[model samples]
Target: MDASHHPCGGIPSRLPGGGGAPRPDARGWPKGCPSTVARERIRVPEATRRVKPAAACIVRHNYYPDTHVRRDAEALVEAGYDVSVVSLRRPGQAAREALCGVNVYRLPMQHRRGSSLRYAWEYTLFLFLAFLTVTALHVKKRFRVVEVDNMPDILVLSALVPRLLGVRVILYVFDNMPELLAYLRGWSARHPVVRFLAFLERLSARFADRVIVTQEMPRRAMASRGVPRHKIAVVLNSADETAFVPSAAPDAGRRDVFQIVSHGVILERYGVQVLIEALPSIAAQVPGVEVQVFGEGEYRRALEEQARRNGTTQLVSFRGFAPFDELIATLARADVGYVGMLNDLVLPNKLMEYVALGVPVTASRWPTFLHYFPDEAVAYFRPGDPEDLAAAIVRMHRNPASSRARARRAKELYQDYRWSVQREVYLGVYSELLNGVVGASAMGSRVGAAPYQRS
Candidate 1:
């Protein structure tokens, strides 16, 4: 259950091109060019002029339209601050686009960099390009807040630039970066890059004006690492109720069979195999339970193999990730939402999204769940315990009324965890940064660089 100790599937060390490992780039640096101007060319609008440049910039190397980043950045924009996101653009998306009135700039990524060295070089180049974009955007318009979210804690170092420039740095810690690295190496020897990243994480946490984590576990972990509780705010992932709300019920014919659905990246930590192996037992007990997995990842082939091995290939189907609207449609059709994450340090955000859609969620039990979900709210089975999971699935199938009630309750509870709440928390953070109430020196008064703690 402790994935921090699990060995990760081996990944190549040198990406193609032998470029340095990718790190988040400096704000306002030009994309793909070193000598180009780093600042923005556009003039600041009068409406935005009243609002001081945010010391914080939401930074992530991950793609845009990522639910949380987009939602948070949009909320920040509504609160009247300059927000720019630095991330990789998929081949199809344009280099720049304004969505929900927020400026989103994407840099080209070299996915072809097959080796780790090439990947690192490409990513570093990405960072530099992103920095140029950020600089141009910021100089053209002042920004005061620099927020770093997503994985690869090396990006945390980006906070240093803003801090040096007198801007407040906020760490929106989502996943634990070092734990992820160790997992990749099968929890074996630590790599120098991982060590350096760990070092950077410590420095960033120590100096960050505020620390925002997704769940209580990370907050406590950060606290143990010396981040004060006051400086840390627990910002759990919230569902976009407006986008995910259930639509009118489909016809009884369309709902003739019970549909169980799961989505997102299909990776080891998602524990899809356990669920597949449990299907035979579930089928023996429940007459019409069908499990559909949405999304693809490293573990997909293994999952297919398990389904074939278990002879439940007929009941289990692999449906890859769908567009947002289509995903909502699938959620609407799904009677039970299967929520899984290899019992590990991080909680699965999809579970929250599932609950928001008002679907009864059945998940692999993890310690992280205790922090946010009530025992009654979810039907939890031991991590990787096929029998327990099958039994839980059977229990839900046999008790449709109870399942329906639970789903209704989950939807009602979803309001408390909605972005409406997160918006206010972010606004408070921005206000704190703008007032300069918290300074870099104050941050230094906190603990020094400390290694990330494992469960």
Candidate 2:
């Protein structure tokens, strides 16, 4: 297969070609990096891979290298499934390429989260384009499964043809879109836009043969809307113990300055703004305190402006993204790793990353976070409260021995959520869906040929 250009959209392909190791760009946040997991996150040679491939088509609106979607694709491939990712294309990325062992096709469209109408256009446009692309790919070689990772939520509807051919459709929802938009935009649950989003979300769940949510809250939320319990899978965003090999570290006593680290897209709902608010208070209590933020987003520029406005730019630094190994090493060396998001329902990916690296952690205190992370495992602070977060940081600073002990406890608890342990659940769900176990009325919701038979 000549996987070099987009299958559709006559927009004459443009490419800066392959992705080299990340170097500082003008904005300084690894600007041109093509994907998050650049074969650095997964590796399985063709000679060693299983001969029989359970063919799969995975779709997402995000970049091809999104950690969660990439991890899921890697898991499917590891379980003898041939996986192909349909993802968005940025400036520097090629329209098509292979990462690790999974084939990827990038569509010629990109959308940033914004207004209600803007989201509507972007989602509808991508849905039409992706539907055409997947249909064409399906004719080339049949796929037994189509998995859609959500943001718009209803992208699974793009698998119309395959679903007609009896291919199972799985809705792999990473975050609850309605709740996320509500929090980000400060919209009430009963608001028109929020209710509309909730309706779309329900449509997406109803359209899928199986729904995979990152945490228990979403699963229960879906169940409350009448989706069967068995149809929903609770797959937390846990670290893979085998994949992350921690680097050697020095004693905390040797460091004179108190350093804190946070990474990933600097979104407003993540409450990184709260981190900015806490900096002055933290500096007052501990003069040498510095917060190193890696990764970039529109919110990052806002954060930098906020730091300048507060005259605390010296206390915060935007270090930008590094190669996977170096990024982990940076966190492993930090005194404290923080997950300061405003929402409590979703699991913080960075929290798991912090736990895996055995880094002393301080995170927003919420029922959802505490459900998975116990009090002894991680220090907590009130979400959206700068004073509380600063106090949490100071507590960790004053008692290094206690925090280290908590990190050790967290690491032991994280063992169960590893990809090694969790992959089986994903496979089991796919296996059931493939066997024609329509836990819900997927066929009726689908606009395809009558019902499919048991394979």
Candidate 3:
């Protein structure tokens, strides 16, 4: 089913922070001073260099180049935690190697994504192997915390042994299973599968000592399921300034045709196809318009076919994937950065990258986005409406001054949501967890009994 027809709750239409907003400083930044140092070299305490990390992280995928994970792990290391990462072994990744002061461990396993049964088999095997790997590492040298980056939400179970041994378990929810499945399978909230997955999601959150959500909607989802508000942390996936700072030559020169670009995972619900559909219309108005896609996924071919059907085959260009530096260079030269995602639940990294580089953003005006970005910083368009997106493109093309103003505000807004702010928020959570500052009842409630057993 096309995402437009998915039976789900309608996103609120009002803009956030307009009526009454959270104090920007109170949100995460310091009360008086701006913190932008994560862009520079992170300082590691020589005194604590040899000390054990505050936590050990187990990510299902290889972490050598995962931007956010790498950024946060480095922050933790610099903050006196001797972090270790257990990740998948890619084609040539060493089974054991250290990167950026974090000791790395690899388990040999391949992943598949086509079928439900295949996913279950792979996740189950990973849950089992990751359990053994983390347990052994803990026995060798204990860590105070065990962090799991969830895809298979229940993989937090891998940290059971350590939690039983007095370590804290943190489940970082990159994506929630319920909404993901409902959106992906085009199932209604009332669907049995959706309900079952929601049950499992709550179950996993209940088992973890603390839950971290990448965005506010997921936090609400957990809280609605009876998880205490305090037990969950909202760690916005802010961009690291080192990698996403404003381009040295942000406003170089636009080609005869305007460039609209998006770089990230190619997913159906993300509404990139809508962007492609809008291209033909955009070209009608702004004859100088091109769409540059710089990512790959199962959805790529479908988008290409759609472009062909829309007669935008020549207008939409897929550059596949490239290193971050190359992406930055390409984006620096773009006239407008595109983020047309329809999912109210997702906030793609492309949005942050585009805004940081002072590129005018044209995104689906989902309410959750309003919470983070004011309407002025990002041009609003109806989700799943290609014409609306085309209208936005035309507006930017016609009134470059207004577009430039929005881009300037976007760059200014980016500072408040930088990695420095989130790094501090993350460390604060760990500090509370490590210092026994969180309410004891909440900590004890989850750790009393973890759901999995590896023995």
Candidate 4:
């Protein structure tokens, strides 16, 4: 994928291929760099001046190497939209950069943990920087759309200035923010801050020109919160098939004895505790059933302590956060991949990624999983039920043939979630916005085939 060539419309003079040296991304993550995940291809006719080039500005608080955002920007660019992303600094990113044809600007900040002071400082700084970026970019470029990837739910404000400038704003929600924070803190909605956040969330949803949610439950949740059903679109959080390709089966010696893997944030909301509590029974029933827990989060320490207390610390290993290839390789070796969420309004992205990897999954019996895996591809265990989780683990370990069969079935189901299809749906949203198509059913009809809406 050459950054020089536009996938959809004729090349613009501003793009590097037609002019002087390409603008060096201040962030180390450079555009068209081999190290970054490339966007999936989707064909759109070269956009002419008849349609104004839509400018997309993404506002995200916490950052990851998001392939969805990358592909979303790429699709808009291919369709002749000028793309600019505004996000907070992650570990290795520079303050600014151009990535695979997208303008990415980072707000610099000191890393802080869970202190209220830190949260205030971070959000305040992000808000200030974001407003500056939006004002500067809009003055020079004609951006007609602003996209907010929700985790903090504060990104919806990014559209305020743009809307005042007559640009449309789309809120792209990946997780249910209020519920996620409550899950993380183990606090209930009764908490004052939780209540305040819920209020803010409802207000944000109301302000968005269009709302996008990852799962059906969140879409319903948004509607319940007073966001009209017609203003929302169900856009799922998906893995880029371009990055997580299937690899050759590993040599027997290279695989764990009784391999089990779980990715994403290893936190309580993910039900890592159930896996922790199941470890002792699983170890006794199937000796040397080593478990590999990937990603880092609040629950990591608790899980490690539980393993130690149960005397199964030797049997469990924490791989922390691995890079892209290592994470995929780890997934490829998993005999039984785990997926879970504390009954939330959104599905976990890992469920789709694991399924795409063709691994037999043992997931919590939640509406989110049920929505995705109606087939026997996913083996259900009672949510937070350690005994049930242990039994499910032992069953898969005992029946390798059944596990492999489930893996094959899961892969077949995941075929619908290919990046090409996902990119097209996203582009449709941008096209709708650029063409002044904002309604209950923008773009004429819903993207019914999105795998995130599995049911």
Candidate 5:
């Protein structure tokens, strides 16, 4: 009794609308009876007929609560795509969870600072784990796109399986690895290690269907280094305005203590030591001036010791790693926000956060900062010079009216780089990539018309 040869098998011969059984046809079955193949071709239920959303995955070595990754993932979720993030997991965090509509799968590894070999081992482990995780997820969820955020650049290779399956791949370059390595290790660009990093970067960029950079500087850097201009898109690291809005309180600016705040990873290259060194002079000029440092990193102990040596330990408080809401409240109440990075290659997100919150900024006069912020919008100080920073802080304290004006100007300038505006640009990049129209000329046209001016 093979079902294929049975006239009706288990299926009913009569249609739903009939009042009586239908008459048999020449084949000795009811007229208009559906054949086995026709039965299999019945219409799907209306509820199940809707199109399934395309799936997207973000692969980064960092842990969750990463502002950039979270922002991008949530944006994709909002755009009706099913988004998943594969990232490092810290102790006490769940291995898998849904956050703000984005599914996050945390690997059982934590990032640690260490020597070159140690870093290599860690990256390799994460790369292998990522490769396995993405491949498995794609088999189940069928990811249409995979985006890899790079530190080693070659992490983009983890998506090889997905790319081979015709999934679009994106390489999001947060830092130029070669330039950063050269800057951190005092290596020349022509050094063998630096050249190797550059080669890896080019390979990663070529492997990816598209490359995304934080700003114009990196976009140009990648292009000049032989990355196809059309393959690159500029999506800035602007502050999320909803979380960094100006305080509505009338007394938000009326602080009894003149507090200066700097928040982010405390790295020497970021020049937090410069701010601490300038504290004594700043306190001398502006009485009761308090410097609040909110963040934690390898440089925290060095900065603390520097503060003690400068005899301004009492004035500078190390409030390490406050929650995002707390950080925003502190920024709102602060009299001035500080960004003291030592190089032009780094564009500090804290600068944009300060501006987004309408806090007057005192930042290093690096090319990257200057390109985005005009002199009138920020009180500029020379890089690594405590004396100049002290003067800049003193000037802000002495002329509150002028500082307020600069803050207003900074807020106006921030309108151009606010996440609200940049989110669309980011989504457009995805749209282009998914549509298979992402090209050098198309990317160039979009970037050229973007709010940020070219460097």
Candidate 6:
């Protein structure tokens, strides 16, 4: 878990002090020291020496501390692969650092929300920088696999050099770009620009040796777009249970107030406004009802205004982005977790985290939500309908026993998609692609298992 910072964009040629044989650190410096300190001779673990050296890199457009990217990178490290993540450099973050056994190399660029042209320019610039960084890292690390997570699906092109060098490339589709674009731009799916994104998506998928998607819906979406079905694998973004523990029994002191929590980027499509609109009805039915909004984004200002206009300003509190542990603590205390997305395609990770913590959830009845959570496990409301959402919340508040029972059911259903189970599935994708040679033993008896073939 030790991390060392480097100011340079690429791997440092040598440590700070004069030369000696580079030593392996706890975070796995396979060839060279990740730290800049003087080298010293140290005993390498037998397991480390016996295992075939496999290096992998993940290229993501976001900053470090990204839950999905961190989970995947750490899983690789645990499976005996040296993992590195290439991402954006946010303010006050190190240019290069090792975290939780994964080495992170952040570029100089920052992510900003703006017009389509601005987005295009930023994506293009990051793509170019990533290509250069990955090419340079491969020269030293010789990564056996390069995985790219997408906002712009074409980021997979950053690995072109490595792909040409016989390294396996994986395009991990976090979201269906075309569908997201259509939703954000209010354009028809058949719009020329949306269709162009679909074209790029297909090309990206075809370029990768395999594609990893969050769930079955996106996998099917990719397959229908001419990306071969077998080439795609589903890796659910379930909560890391070790960090997100189930809440202790309800406190009698908290019974005076109904606490509802929703956390994630505050975008219009996420439907936070719908939740705010429902707050008045919820408070009227269940007095002392309070809503905690966590995380910040472009739509926050408008959401605050809407809360004020609805006369529910006191009922709703916007608690901006908090640390992971703090967020989990907040979720654990909630009487209900709210997911009010207008879009049906995304399976929100926040929903999974809520379930993981044994928090009762009232979620939008999106196809993706229904696909994952059975009717008995969650109380679902019509998406973007304030009245239905309010009714759902009131019902849960009035029927505490039913709410807890439903939460229990959710925890049970979550077992099928929790991180431990999905991590193996994720590693299996790499194992299968590498011909069952790399990390095959980590997959245990499922070594040759067909890469998560569940439809």
TM-score of 2: 0.83
Give one digit per residue, the lDDT tens place, for model 6 in 271-357: 889989988888889977999987766678999999889898888889875544466677798999988878777688788888988
Q: Each model's TM-score, in the order given?
A: 0.78, 0.83, 0.84, 0.82, 0.84, 0.84
Tens digit per residue, CA lDDT, model 1, 1-455: 12111112111111112122221121111123221121233344566554444423677766665435656776665554556777666655667665554567767762342565765675566567756666666566555677876454555565555566776677777766666667655664257866665676666777777777776777776676666777877665665566566555533365347788877667777777888888888888777778878765668999898888889889998976444455676777777888767746666667777887777888878877755676667888888888998888888888877877877777676676776565565566666566555533222222111111112
Cα lDDT tens digits, model 3, 176-231, are 77888888778899899889888888888888878888878888888998888888
Ranking, lDDT, top scorer first: 6, 5, 2, 3, 4, 1
Q: Which stretches of candidate 2 lie over 4 Å from their true place?
A: 1-52, 112-114, 435-455
Best of the two (2, 4) by lDDT: 2
lDDT of 5: 0.75
Q: Report how far off residue 258 is in candidate 1 (Å).
A: 2.5
State each model's CA lDDT, in order: 0.63, 0.72, 0.70, 0.66, 0.75, 0.76
| Ranking of predictions according to TM-score | 6, 3, 5, 2, 4, 1
Deviation of model 4 at 108, angstroms? 3.0
Clashes of 1: 41
Per-residue alpha-carbon lDDT of candidate 2 for residues 1-455, written as tens digits (9 for 90 to 100): 00121111011112233254334432222344323444356454555443345678998876665556666787666555778999888777778787656788989987565666777788888899999999998887578889987766878889988988888898887767777667767889888977887888888888788898877778878887777787788776776665455555645565568889988666676788898888998988875888888776557889999999987898898976555656667778888988887877577767887888889999888887787788999999988999999999998988889999999999888887666656666666776666655543221121111112223
Measured by lDDT, the strongest candidate is 6
Record all residue pairs in model 3 with backbone atoms less than 3 Å apart, i.e. clashing: 53-82, 257-288, 258-288
Task: Give the count of colliding residue pairs in each prediction.
Answer: 41, 0, 3, 7, 1, 0
lDDT of 2 at 354: 83
lDDT of 4 by residue, 1-455 (tens): 11111111110112212122244221112235332333234333344434445466777664423435555666556555667887656555566777657787867753456576667666767677777888788787756678877655776776677788788788877666677667657789788878888888888777777888766788777788888877787655666566566556644464338888877655466677788788888888986688888766666899889889888888788987555556677778777888755564556667777777777899889876677676478888888898998999899988878887887887776776555565566666665665656652432354321111011
TM-score of 3: 0.84
lDDT of 5 by residue, 407-436 (tens): 899889888788877877787777776665
